[model samples]
Target: MIPMPARIIAVCNQKGGVGKTTLVTGLAEVYTQMMGKKVLVIDADPQYNTTSALGLSGPEFTLNDVLYGDESNNQKIFPGVAADAVLEVGEDWQSPNHSELGLIASERNLASRERDSMMAREHRLRIALKGVAEEYDIVLIDCPPSLGLLTVNALTAATHALLVSEPRVASVEGLAEIVTTIAEVQENLNEDIDIVGVVVNKVRKGRKDQDVWIEKIRTDFGELVLDPLLPDRELFAKAQAAAKPLKSFGSEAKVLRADLEQLARAIWKGSEA
Candidate 1:
């Protein structure tokens, strides 16, 4: 059996096009495949890209059902309702290991819940996953690219936060805002939530501006910046496109896979720098 009270990590970025969704699915895959953890991915984002990348298509019970309850069954946020929404991934891919991966998928309708004026809106996701989270060793929340209610709900539920950014001025600039948001969440919502590290993703080697931005990120964030920078690779897109494991791409995917595995290790170990 997996450990009780899973380490829930909210993979967040306030800016779009920074590959936040990609990192979520990649880390989920790593946690399950390399580290042998029972993983549950909560696609809190409305776009639901992470849901699709995980090979789940048109799931009937999604995060929407978990948050607002499945009206068809007249089920509200009761104990284990979130578990009811979870579906196993990679059954079609025929990988026994991938079978361990579970997901509370997302759909476009999830976006509307953010504007929900109901009381205790930020606590919805937390309430839904109470008993369900303990079934997995790791729970990764794929937050939307905005510091909105959805992101706040993810923060309110998470035990840790992993900030992902590209080596660009615009992307790096948004990091401060997200950091501030996390701080706010700690002050008001979930005080136990901590930032594990900052992942500088999609680095283009030898690009002058990117080099400068990466340095700035390290200088500003200090030991919080995790190492083995993720380079801009087509393999990430390819593997995600096929809904296949990164290692399945063969020899060409070795280095990137190793990097991801190492990164996953660092995150799970709660290492800094």
Candidate 2:
């Protein structure tokens, strides 16, 4: 029997283009392929970048329908395109047109629903997701680049949060804001909510400035900073354009693969703790 993986992790950072969607999608793939776990990704961002990166588009039914409208009817829940439709990255770093994975696509229309709803009902995403909590081994929520209703709902629903940051002063500053927000959410909204750790992405090794910022973040956050930083890689951008993940690309460079794998294990073990 597959052990029940009931952890819900939210990848959040108040800064856009900081690899939030990329990390979530990549980690989902790792969890499925490496750990033999079923993972569900909830793209809560209006950009739908995660949805697109996962090769899901033209959504008929999305999280919006579940949160704002109604998914009480079985027919109303639309499973996204077949997994084989997703682009795949090969071992030679070649691109292919197939994958064996799953994703719950998101739509830009979700923003409109947020605007129409009152503040209290903003937690609809959290409430809606609770219904399917047991369906998958893990659920990853990709939050928007702001502390809005969408982000709050993600934080409230998540058992833990992974604050992704780039090795830059601005990105670290943005992480601070997210940390503060998580504290607020834990105190008032979800007492069980805790920060899993901070993931420093796009890290350039041996750079003096990058090392400085990284050390500062470690000093400030201490054990909250996860080791094995995700290095900046051009392949990631290429995979995104082709709508595939890095691991699919088949490049077995030890550093990048090890970092991501370690990240997945860290999250899993942290949840267990």
The model with the greatest TM-score is 1
Where model 2 places Cα greater than 4 Å from the true spot, the runs are 1-5, 71-101, 252-254
lDDT of 1 by residue, 1-273 (tens): 654578899999899888887788788777777777888889999898888888888999898878886556643456567888888886543335643788899999998887777677888889888888988888899999999999999999999999999998888878989999999999999999999999999999879989899999999889889988999998889877888777677899889878888889889889222
Task: State the TM-score for model 2.
Answer: 0.84
Give me the candidate number with maximum lDDT. 1
Candidate 2 residue-wise lDDT, 1-273, digit = tens: 644535889899888888997788778767776677767777889888888877765877676666554335532322322221222222322223322344566788878765655445645556565546556678889999988878988898788898999888888888989989999999888898888888989987789999999998899889988888888888777777777666656655445666778999988888874
Candidate models: Cα lDDT each: 0.85, 0.74
Instruction: Give lDDT for model 2.
Output: 0.74
**Residue 93 alpha-carbon offset, candidate 1, angstroms:** 5.9
Candidate 1 clashes: the total is: 0
